[model samples]
Target chain A: MYRDPSDVNRVASLGAGPIGGGWTAHFLARGYDVNAYIHDPAERDALMAVVETGWVSLTGLGLALGASMDRLTVTSDLAEAVEGVGFIQESGPERLEIKQALYKRLGEIVPADVVIGSSTSGLTMTEIAAECETPGRCVIGHPFNPPYLLPLVEIIGGKQTDKAAVDWAAAFYEVAGKAPLVMKKEVPGFVATRLQEALWREALHMVANGEATPEDIDIALKNGPAPRMAVQGQCMAFHVACGEGGMATNLDQFGPALKWPWTRLEAPELTKELRDQMVDGCNAMAGDRHFRDMAAERDRKIVAVLKAVRDG
Target chain B: MYRDPSDVNRVASLGAGPIGGGWTAHFLARGYDVNAYIHDPAERDALMAVVETGWVSLTGLGLALGASMDRLTVTSDLAEAVEGVGFIQESGPERLEIKQALYKRLGEIVPADVVIGSSTSGLTMTEIAAECETPGRCVIGHPFNPPYLLPLVEIIGGKQTDKAAVDWAAAFYEVAGKAPLVMKKEVPGFVATRLQEALWREALHMVANGEATPEDIDIALKNGPAPRMAVQGQCMAFHVACGEGGMATNLDQFGPALKWPWTRLEAPELTKELRDQMVDGCNAMAGDRHFRDMAAERDRKIVAVLKAVRDG
Candidate 1:
């Protein structure tokens, strides 16, 4: 049903927004001929612009042997775009009905054995696969921002998804130089997003209370836990912090602090003022750079970190 | 009272345990003459072992000019460690009584202008400065593990702490290649540690409930948020996730989900079973490597990340 990444040369991107365009750029950079499908004809220009911008970023990260911008093909015909692609990555709008309808249409076109992965961030594959003709082949292939650079791809399967398909997608992503973590359980927002949400909620609470600024929070992570995080996982690092006591010592020492208000997991209300603050704060952090330029800069930094993590 | 990093030749480590030894190694790597105070005469060999181990990792990260183990001087006599040093870094112990007693003794010995920094992770500077005659000079200069590699040093001031002293310490740390985040208002765990505690608490709960393994939780971070975390803060990354919508869209979309059971900020009871699983999970992750070896590897990787972040 599936082949190695070498054999699976053509991949289909079933939406050409930022996430979808990112998938296209990543696939192209991985030397896969990317056939992108879009509902609107005007999107061809904007989507390809994203691909060209991403291409430069991927180049800084280093591309595959046969990678090129010429590998991207935009098509108005949905069936034609996915025709014989070994893999289908869908990044449609977040609406359930929209995704279900797209999956139903894609199922009718793509080969039944070819794996179809949804880049849906929070939606579960179980719900998304409900309308697919061959539910067993559908799974979540969630990638972090600027997919060509950040290596993590969460491989999650729905109740109907075949474990084999999940394994195949996981293996394929690895060959494409992505770190894929398979979730045994289907948790909303997945693990990373869940962890991220906790910290994010806490940050918002701080901003609302004026305890800290957004720039301060960003600087805290970029210069602090992240440098350590690039090397070892947070829990593993906590294990090291336990000294002779291991996690047991850390748990004993810091466990009580959890009951304290260290983190406000419950989000602050997004009042008009708070909303304005958050937006203004982020804009200030971005400063003069355009989003694409900031993204390219992010991709460059991520590449360096990835290289260090791999080589070290 | 403080001089440029080049002019400030000597710094003192009031304790020669893991944290103190780390400070010693880091100070030495920054080309400071490090005088380390230990409780027992027999502790010198073990303390030096830790410093020597840290030096190799720091050297790999690129050592400062004149950096060497030859610059480290260990003594059991407290006065010998702090008498001539420009700054004092106290990582003695967590017990408030022990730290207060030590600070009182140091206040009587060291010069009033020589700033004394406590590496106490959770304890506030005010509590630690209670017994010090010159409490204004005492500040919290908390460093993450393997301080030579990780850039963050949380600089906090006590109630009696002079604003100028805090500013001076912040400036001094920046000169030593450390990113200092000054706490405008002190909380229980401070910023990074507070954020870390929330994630850690949630991770423990997941493991306790059999929802995820320790490795699963760790892989989730290393693969998912860590790469992103290496570059941007979690909050900044969330800002990017909002697309053109920015932070307001992110909040509108996901803020309500915060009430969901994504993170259990209240930690699970540290039952024997949970503790054993945690220790065993971390041990399995470490495999045959000794703690020191694991620490060394972590140091090397952190150095790589720091280099990437700095250069990229």
Candidate 2:
């Protein structure tokens, strides 16, 4: 069952570090009572320090209805950390044995209904779920660096995971001001990491081949394609490329380039769902403008940008 | 010698298509007297419409000093268009024969001292210059789409091209309210297109695979990576990723990811120049703060964002 945000007043964060500390701070700043715990009691000072430092940034981000630093309860024992908590965020060491054991033990203590979110970078839920008796309660809540800062939280459910758990976490995250990207299926690296990996790899390739300097690479993005990305995503950008032609025109062009091996990657076959999504996104960004008119208007508005960076 | 902006008041546009029209509008809006010519006089009406339409956006972007749409003079004759002009921008078809023939003709009309810049997207300067008698006066001044708005103009010199011509074009572009991305050497797709191509290919791959819908892909970037890119480039983003360790730490972590077959594209070996550029770019972005501090600051600032997106 999808738990209501109001019902999740207290959340538990295990294995406090940079990500865990940030998550704790976020929960606290969002007016939730966060019961935070680490592997050992000796790291209490460091954990609190991370939360305090993170608090400054969170406060800057603006506090919620009852947000406060005082709402955080630091615990030494794992069971004590989970005490009376409605939700669990596991940010433990990225080790198989430790996490497998931790989840198994936590599963016995916490109620079967409570959803446990792991902040694993690469570990799949299928592997971690094996250790949990209530496997349905476990899910992946992989966050980018600085959890309190970056708004993205990629949610992926593995084999033996319940849809309810994923839904609960996604709903909870939306209420908490995070952009929860819930994947339909488990994909390696997820969407953000995979896309970033592709771009980064190409960048490295160019640099290694004496193609361009790092500064040169960065400046190009800052000035050109990235500004468009800042406003629109890659699919929409291609949609805009079609001028009045829309997605069909884009695909027509994309077809030749796909075969060219332009950037070392090959494209998957064009499915109807992907095409429809591409077209719909462009229409949304297009607003009242006709498909063709959107292109003219796009080119027009782009021609009229305010002096973002003035030259002396 | 860098020609004075005043001495270069009269500029010639050797094509009146989209790019040519955009260039004409930009020059006119920047207060330069422009002599614009296309292949046919019948296209004059169409070209002027493009400029007039582009002017609305140009005015919104804020016109340059003494900028006016009234200063544009459209001509059908090639010699008449280039007569007594300080600089000539060729916006011809991407055909080898057409560009070769046009540049050869324009080279004869304009003095050897007047720099002629080509708007060829992918054509090398070496190929285009071979057609020109005074190749020293020819250089690549490739502008991004919707040139009147976007500030980027990648300036590349050919194998036989003179540095003086490149320098003059760069100075002129800066004076024209364009970001002159002066290249150290010529590479395929230059910096902007290369990076864009890389990003675009991955987007296509994702769409083809049915792993995620197009809307999902766009939203992921718009809400996640693009914002960082809008404010800072990729190199700086990685520097911030190092937490407090800075570039050194980033490299250490990136070292493993680089080896991973995360993307279909393979990374070139990390040569010294590539490594140094990455480090230096990060250091520059880091500024006074050590790399570790940047991570703390990045998190803090991100936390402080009162809903990063305010505009509708």
Candidate 3:
């Protein structure tokens, strides 16, 4: 039987690059004694530098009780790093073969019930855990850059992984001060990354076509939509913009614009089925709040964000 | 001779919908007496409601000296609204025919030197001004929704528009407390809208495919990239993520992911020329600030925003 995520204490952080170092800092800030494994001992100084830099923002955000840098332990021996840890977070290189070999080794060293979460942003857990004897306990816990600051950690389970392990990882991330988005099904780049890449590609197209420069795009985004998006996501923002009518009103008003050659990506046709799904989805997100109330909340948050940005 | 944009005190706001009403409120908050034109008399209450609600947030953001909502005047007669006004902001229907007819009448009413800025997000200035007698004075001053709070105003000129008019409009927006992105060339949806549409389409695709729910996307975005994007934009955010190496290191590190089918939208080829342009653009945006300093500033702003969000 696996130990409940709440009962887990010490954790192993494999690899100490940017993502790995960020995870190490995050785990340490959460009051966990971290055994950080690096491939080469020469990276020790650089890894320490990341932890120190990350600690500043973590302190500002408030550190967990009993959190200290002294609790961190670094080593080059893989077996020593994984010894007696309750959980394992692997942030190895983005290579299928390397990850398979690493997982295979990790599977043999750790108990069958110990969860191993890979931090590979590109490769999926399905491929990474292919050679592991205990693939059922392996999952993906992808974090955005500067993981200690950003609250999102995308949780995905591979084809062979057990659902219980995915649940355990999600609960663990939540306990560790993260908003874990447990995906229903695996997709390329997951949620946030896909959305980001789509917008990024469009920006690149504009620059390549000479429609706008990089600086122009940045100014347009930061000044126009970025602040609002920070407060409310795209769908909710549009729903609130239509006032009391909500998503149905928004779709009717601007759905035709989606068909317009506004973006290079061809939009999925707005069939009635898709339309209903979106309307219902937004309604569910809104819960019992009226459009006016949601709009007020959005406005309040936006004001706070603008003030913060201005003061900073 | 046209009065300079700085000297313009009273302006005409044609149409009384959300965009026009928001613009009316923004202009009033900026201490301008606005002559608001509406086609129907029944829309008076709705327009007033928008202005009233917008005022609350505008007040929170701080009002300009001598600002007053009582300075606004509503009129049904088009000719009466444009009379003696120093500038005109037409947010009439998005249809090209309605706008062309409206612009033709306005061109006949106002002085040839008086600048006219349209808030049309879809139709281009070139198409709208084709029927006008003085197309040279007409320019696009497209704004995002809830224009009273958001600071962006994209300034683009039609083929027939004079360069001086675009300059005057950009200068005027600055005086009105708006960040105007003067586009080098007009493209479909311009910059911000295109970027937004690309992301929205991908989001729709995800929902239609049952890969994720609206709530999941919202949580993923708001918790992950939205806060950072609020501080530094997409390009600069990635630039800072790579630390001291800036864009060059970032492109070399994650540029391959652009081709990874991460998004439905196809990415532009990352050619040598494109890479150079992106690097130079980011370097220009960074100015003399070192990467460490920029990263520190970004963290400070993000922390402030997170605190505001949490407190709100």
In model 3, where do residues sit more than 4 Å from their true spots?
B77-80
Clash number by candidate, in order: 0, 7, 0
The alpha-carbon deviation from the true structure for residue B77 of candidate 1, after best TM-score superposition, in angstroms, is: 1.8
> What is the TM-score of each predicted model, taking all chains together?
0.81, 0.87, 0.95
lDDT of 2 by residue, B44-79 (tens): 988988788778777876777788878888888888
Q: Give the least accurate 10-residue stretch of model 3 chain A, judged by summed lDDT.
A: A238-247
lDDT of 1 at A251: 51
Question: For residue B17, what is the lDDT in candidate 1?
Answer: 82
Every candidate's lDDT:
0.72, 0.76, 0.89
lDDT of 2 at A134: 88
What does candidate 3 score on TM?
0.95
Clashing pairs in 3: none
Error of 3 at B238 (Å): 2.0
Which ranges of candidate 2 are over 4 A from the true structure? A28-31, A40-63, A266-289, A292-312, B5-7, B28-31, B38-63, B75-77, B271-274, B284-289, B292-312
Q: Which stretches of candidate 1 lie over 4 Å from their true place?
A: A1-6, A241-312, B1-7, B240-312
Tens digits of per-residue lDDT for model 3 on A25-125? Answer: 99999999999999999989988988888888888888999999999999999999999898999998888999999999998999999999988887888
